[model samples]
Target: MKLPPLKTLPVFEAVARTLSFSAAAEELHVTQSAVSHRIRQLEDDLGESLFDRHGRRVALTEEGERYLEAIAPALAQIERASQQLRGQSDTRLRLAVPSSLAVRWLIPRLPHLQRRHPDLDLTLEMLADMPVMSERLADAFITIRYRQRGYVSTPLYVERLFAVCSRQYWMQMRESLEDAGLREKGSGRSIRPEWLSRFTLLSAASVFEKPGEDWRRWFQAAETEMPPTARVQQFSHMLLAQEAARHHQGIALSNDYMLDTASDPELVRLRTHEFRTGDEFHFACKQSRAKEPGILHLSRWLERQAEASGWR
Candidate 1:
C-alpha cells in the first residue's frame, strides 16, 4: 500500500486539530489558500473527505478524526526529537549573577555543577551595578534587589548583613593592647568599648547610597548609637569590600552568603546581630523563557541549595 505524502499529513493534522483553515495556516506560517489546497489534495489521495464545511468553520469527519489520532503523536514525537538534537548542539547556559555573589557563593559551587552537567557549557557574566534584565544576553539572572513589576521573579532567599573581620586582625589588636600596657582592657573575647574608635569601617558603595541603612543602620538596629567619626573606606564592589576585610584591611559589613568559609577561614563574623534591610535575593527571567526546561532546572536547583544552606 502506498503511503500518503508526509508533508500533507502535517497540514491535515493542523486543520483537523484546529478545525479552522485560517488558524492552521497562521500556525504553519503559510497562506490560508495553501492550507486548504493541501487538505484537498490529502483527501483526494485518501479517497475520503477530511473536513465538513459549516459556513465559516470546519469540522473533521469521523475518518479524519481517527487518522488524526493515529498520526498526531508520531508527528509531535518527530518535532520534539528534532528540537532535542538541536538543543544538544547548543547546550550552553548563560547565567547573569551579581559580582559579589558570583565570587562568594556561585563560584565555589561551579565544580559541583560541572560534575552534574558535564555536557552543559556554562557561562557566567557579572551583572551591572544596577539591576536590569536583557533577554538576549542571559538565559537566567540572580539579583539582590527589591521586587520589580512586569518581570517574573521568584524569591530565593533573604540575606542578613553583619560586620566581619579577620582572625589575624583580632590577634594584632590584642598584641597592640598588651604592648601599650592596656592589657588590663576588658575581656579580649568581647570587642573593646573603644574599638570602633580605633579602626576603620569598610563597606560597599551601596551603604553610602542608602545612608539611612548603612553600617550605622545596623548599629542602630542593635540599639546602639552610631560611632562618631568612624573611619570609612568604600569599595566599588561588594566582593572587593569582602576581600579587603579578608586581608584585614579593615572591618566590613557583609552577608553570610557572601563568605565562603571553606575557602577563606581567616574571615570571622564580628557581630552576632544582623542588620535588617529591605533587600532580598530573587531569580528573575523573562516571561518568554519561564517554561524552558533549563531555566526550570536551574531555578529548582538554586532553591534546593538555598534550603540546604538554611536561607530564609
Candidate 2:
C-alpha cells in the first residue's frame, strides 16, 4: 500500500491535536493558510474531512480523533527510531545545575561519567539557585531543596554548612593570637565566636539571604549573633564567593555538597561549629520523561557518586 505524503501527516496531527489551524501553523512555523492547505490536501488524499470548522474554531471529526490516537504514538516511535539511527537516542542529555555545584562537584566527576557513558553527549548549563518550572529550560535540573510542581524529583544529598577560609588566613589568625599570647596552648584550634565579625564575611547572592541557610541562621545555630556592622562582601553566586574564600579574601559559608574536599588544600573548614539547614540536592525533570532510560541511568549513577563521596 502506498502512503500519503509523509510531510502532511505531521501537519494533520498538529491540527487534529490542537484543533486550531493558526495554532498548528504557529507550532510548525508556517502560515495559517499553509496549515489549512495541508489539512485539505491530506483530506483529499484520504477522501475524508478530518475536522469540522466554524470561523476561527475547529474540532476533530470522529475519524480525525481515531486517526490522531493511532498515529501519535507511531509518529513518536518513528522520531525515536530516527534519533537512534542517528546515534542520538539516549545519546544527549542536557542538564541544568547550580553553578557552585557544577564547578566544585559535577565537573570534577564528569571525566568518570564520560568514561562510563562514552556515547552519551552531556550538555551542562550553570544556573543559579532559582525556581525553574519550564521543561524547555533543560532536560533535567539539579537544584537544592526547591522542586517544581509536576516534576519527578530524585534526592541527591542533604547539605551541611561550614565556615571555611584559606589555610593562610587561619594561620595568620593563629599567629596574631600567638603574638598577643591569646592563643590557647594546645593542638586544639578554635576561634572565638565573637571573632567572626573581625573577619570579612563573604556571601553568595541567594543562599546567604535564604531563611535557613543565611549568616543569621548559622549564627543562630551557633548561639551567637552576627555583628550588625560586620563587613560582608556579596558575590553574584556561590562559586565566586568560594573563589574569594580560597584566595584568603574572607570567610565563606560553604555547603558540604558543593565542596571539593580532596582538591582544595588551600581551604580548610573551621570545625569550630557546624550548621544544617535541612536543604538537599535534587535531580528533577518532567514526570513523563522521568522513566526514560537515559534519565534513570544517569540518576542512579549520580546517586552512587554522591553516596561514595559521602555527599548523601
Candidate 3:
C-alpha cells in the first residue's frame, strides 16, 4: 500500500480537528478551496469519506475520528522533536501574579534573576483582570488565597495586614493637634475611641470577594467598628491603592510584603495591631509538572526566598 503525501495529512488533520474548512484554512493561512482540495485528495487516496457535512457545520466520521486520535499526538511529537533539533528548547517561563505582588515583590527581585541567569527568558504578566491561576496559559502562578484541598500548593507567605499612613500626615497631626485632635482628623469628623473612622480607607477593588477577607476583618479583629462617614477609594490594582496610601491620600490596610520602605518613606505603619486573614500567598503548578526539574528548582528557590524574608 502506498502512503498519502505528508503535506495532505496536515491539511486533513486541521479540517478534522476544527470541523470547518474555513477554520482550517484560516489556521493554515490557505484558501478554503485549497483546504477542500487537500481533503478531497486525501479522501480519494484513502478511499473514505472523512467528514459528514450538515449544512454549515461538519462532523468527523468514525474512521476520521480514529485517524485523528492516532495522528494528532504523532504530529505534535514531530513538531516538538523538530523544535528540539533546532536547539529551541522553547523554555518560555510565564508567570502570572497579582499586580501588588508583581510590583512589590517579583519586580524588585527580578533584577537578581536577570543578573544570575541572563539567558533565561521570562515573561511576567500581571493577573489583575484574571484572578484564577494554574490555567492553560501559565507555566507558574502566584496567588493569595485559602488553601485548596486537591491541588498541590506551596505556602509562600502568610498575610499580615495593618493600617499604614503617611509619615508627614502623622507628623502634621502630632505638631498641630493633641491626641484628641489627631484622632478627630484621622478617623472622621467625629472621633471615636478606635479612631479608625477619621481617615479615608483605601482598598483594592476585589478585596471584598478575595479569600483572605478585607479591612472589615481587620477592624473586627481590633474590636473597632467601621466609621459611618468613612470615605473609601477603590483602585483597580492593589499596588495603585498602596501607592495612594503611601502618598497620604488615605489610610490603607495592606500586608508588609507589599510595602517598600526604601521607595516610599512617607508610608508608615499606623497600627501595631497585626491581624491574620487566614489566607496566604501560594505558588501553584499543575500536578503533572510538579516533579519537572525547572518546576522543582523554582519551587525550592521560592521556599528558600520566603524563609529568608521571614514570611510566616
Candidate 4:
C-alpha cells in the first residue's frame, strides 16, 4: 500500500493550521522554499490541488479541506501512539528554570528522573528567572511565582535564606579564633554578626526579579546592621555567587533549595538561624498540559525530589 510521505503531513498540518507557507516554515524552523516544496510534493502524490494560491495569500481547496479533516486526527493519533510506546503520552517536556536552581538542584537529580521515566525526554531551559511559557519556548517553568498567572502552579518548596562560607574560611578563622572574634556555640564556632564587616560578602540580586533578597535581609533577620563600608562582590546569577563562596572567595547569602548538602563538603553554613522568605519554587504549566502523562510524571518526580531536599 502507498502511504503519503511521512514528513509532508507535518508540513501540511503546519501550513493548514496557519494558512501561510512562510508562517509554517518559521514554525517548523525551515526555509519557506522548503515548505513550498513539501506542499507541492504532497499535492503531486495526491493528484489534487490542496491550496488555491492567490496574489499573496492561499486558501484551502475543497479537496484540501476534506483531506485535512481526515488526516489531522490520524496524525494526532500517530503522535499519541508513538508516545505511548515510549511509556508516556507526551514524550518531550520542555522545562524552564532559574539558572541557580538548574545548576545546583535540577541537573543533579536528572539522572534519576530519566531512569524512572525511561522514555520521557526532559529538556531544561535555564534562565536567570522564570518567563511566560509559550508553544515555541518552554512548555512549563519551575521558579518562584510572584504575580504571574494563567497556568496551573504546584508549589514544591519554600526558600529560606542562610549565610555559607568555605570550609577553609572556617578553618583559617579557627586558627586565629581570638583575633577573628569567633565565639564557641555548643560544639562549633560561630561568627559574631558584627564581625561580618571583616570578610568580603558575596551576593546576587534576587533571582525572583524582586528586591531585598540579599545579605542585608539575612543581617536584618539577625537584628544586626551591615557595615556601610563592607566589601562586596556581586554576581548576576546566584549560581556563580554560590560557587564563589564554595571556593573560599567570600561569604555568600544563599537560599535553602540552592544548597546541595550531600555532595559539597567544602562549604559550611554559618551557625545562625535561617531567615524564611515568603517565596517558593513551583512548577507552572498550562492547565491542559498538566494532565499529560509526561507532565504528570515529571511534576510528581520534582515534588518528591523537593521533599528529599529537606526544604519542604
Candidate 5:
C-alpha cells in the first residue's frame, strides 16, 4: 500500500503530453507552481526525475515514458469502471485527431453529435502529427491514409486546397489591382491564379505531408508559375496558417475539411483556382475493437458527416 498521491499521476501525463509546464497547467486548470510541486512530489516518491527541464521546454525522461505506458491504461480503466458502477450507460471513446482538424472541423460539430447521441461520450486528443495506433492513446483515430497498416480505415474526403485571405485584405488588393489595370475586366472574380505573386504564401504541414507542396501543385494545376517565397510563413498545422490569414497576414492554402462558410464570414476564398490532391482523411480503429457497438456507431456517424459536407 505504498502509493504516491494517486491524483498526481494525471498531472504527470498532462505535462508529458503537452511538453510544457504552462500548457499542462492550462489543461489541468491549475497554476504552474501547483503542477511543478506535484511533479516534484511524484519524482521524490519514485526516486527518479521523470521529466527533463530545459527552461521553457520539457521532455519526459526514459523512466517517465515507461511509467506512462504502465499507468495510463489503468487510469482509463478506472474511470470507465467507476462510470459503470454509477449505472451510467455512456460508451466513452477517446478519439485522436490532428490538432488543426480538431479545432477547425470536429470541435464545432461536437454539440450536434452530443444532441444526437447523448450516450456516446468522446475525449478528443489533439495531435500535431499522425498518432501511433494504441488504445491507450486513443480508442479511434482520424488520420491520413491509415498512417499504419492493419487497421480498418474508410475515406473521408479528398483534399481540395484553395487560396484564402481576410475579406478586408482582398478588397484592398482588388482596388489596387483594378487601378493598376492588373485585374481583368468581366472575369467576375477579384483574383487570378497568376496574381499570387502579389501575396505571401502560408504553408502548413501535418500527417507527414509536405508544407509547401499544395501551393506548388495548385499553381501548376492552374498552369501558373509557382510564386516566389520572398516572404513566406510556415506553420506546423493548418489551423495556425488559417488563423494567420484571418489576421490579414497572408494568403493560405486550406481544404474544405478545415473550413466552414459560416464559421469565418470575414474570410474570402478565391474560387478562381483549386488543387485537388488525391489524398484523403480516413476514420480508423483497432481491428480487435472494430466490431464494438460504440466504434461502429462513431464510424458511421463520421462517414455520414463527411458525405453531408459535400465531399465528392
Candidate 6:
C-alpha cells in the first residue's frame, strides 16, 4: 500500500484550489520553490501531470481536476474533525465576519495576515446567508453587537455609509431637472438632498431590520424624509446593491472600504451627506477564550487593519 507523501497532500490541495504556485505558497506559508518542489514530487509519485502551466498562468489538467474532486471532500472532513478535536484552541480559529466586509476588505488582506502569523490557521465564515449568532457557529465573530451572554467584544469601527449612484444616472437626473426648468441650464452643481426623494433607491436587505430603515436614517441625516412614494429595489446583499448602482439601476448606500472610486469611475458618491451608523463592528469571542493567544493575536491584528484603513 504505497501512499503519496503525506506532506505533499496539503501543498497539492492549496495549489489545486488556487491554481497559482505563489498563492499556494502564501497559503501554506512556504516558499514558492518549496511549492514547486512539492508539486514535482507529487507528480513523480502519481506518474501524471497535475497542472498545465502557460507562462505565469496555470490551470489544472483534466487529471488534476478529477484528483481534486476526490481529495477536496476528504480534506474538508479532515479539517472539520480536527477542529472538533482541537475545541477552542486559538491556533485553529473559525472566524465569521459580515459578508460585505469579508469581500471588500478582509479577503484581500488575508495573505498578509497569514504572513504575519504563519503558525495560525484561519477559516472565514461569511455572514450573508448564515444567521448572525450561535454558540457553535464560529470561534470568533466580527459583528455589530457588543454584548452577548458569554462573549467579550472589541470594537473595530463605526460604520459610515454614503449614497452612491452611477455617474450616468446622476447626469440623466440632472438633465431631467434642467429640462423641467428646476435649475440653471448648464451649471454644474451638487444634487440637492430632496432630489433623492424622486430617485429609485437600491436597498441592501441584509443590513436592515425593516425595509427603508437605512434610507430613512440617511435621509434624516440630510435633513429630509424618505418620501412615501420613493421607489426602492432590494438586493439580498450590499455588493449586489452596489453593482445595481453601477449599472445605473438606482442609488445605493456605501462607504470607502467598499467603493473603489478609481476602478469604478461609473459610481459616484453623493456630495450631500454621509450617515454614520453608531453601531460599531465588534470582534467577539467567548469569555473563556477571550484571553487565548490566537484570539488576542487576531483581535489586535484586526485593530491595526481598521486603523490603517482609516475607518476607525
Q: What are the clash counts of all predictions, listed in order?
A: 0, 0, 6, 0, 0, 0
Best by TM-score: 4
lDDT of 1 by residue, 266-291 (tens): 88876346765667788887665566
**Worst window of 10 by summed lDDT in candidate 5:** 205-214
The count of backbone overlaps in candidate 5 is: 0
Q: After superposition, how far is residue 248 of candidate 1 from its true place, in Å?
A: 2.9
Candidates arranged by lDDT, highest first: 6, 5, 4, 2, 1, 3
lDDT of 6 by residue, 193-264 (tens): 778877899888666656677788888988878888999897876788999999999899987678878766
Model 6 ranges off by over 4 Å: 1-90, 129-135, 178-189
lDDT tens digits, residues 1-312, model 2?
889878899999788767889989999999989988888888999998899989889998898887776687577558767887887665577789888778778888899988997776889977865655454456778877446676888888887777888998888766766776766655476776667767788877666554223667778888988888888887766667778988989888887755665777788887567787777788887786777777777788898998988876
Candidate 1 vs candidate 3: which has greater TM-score? 3
TM-score, structure 6 vs. true: 0.64
Clashes of 1: 0
Q: Alpha carbon lDDT of residue 284, candidate 3?
A: 81
Question: Per-residue lDDT for 311 in model 5?
Answer: 80
lDDT of 2: 0.78
lDDT of 4 by residue, 1-312 (tens): 899898999999889879999999999999999999999999999999999999669899999988887787577657777877887656687788888778777897899998999989989888864555543457678867623645788888787877888999866655565554465433465566767667788878664343334877777778987778888887766777889988889888777667765577788887766777677778888675678788899889998898887755
Give residue 212's lDDT in candidate 5 (0 to 100).
75
RMSD of 4: 8.3
Any runs in candidate 2 off by more than 4 Å, and if so which?
A: 1-78, 81-89, 179-182, 210-213
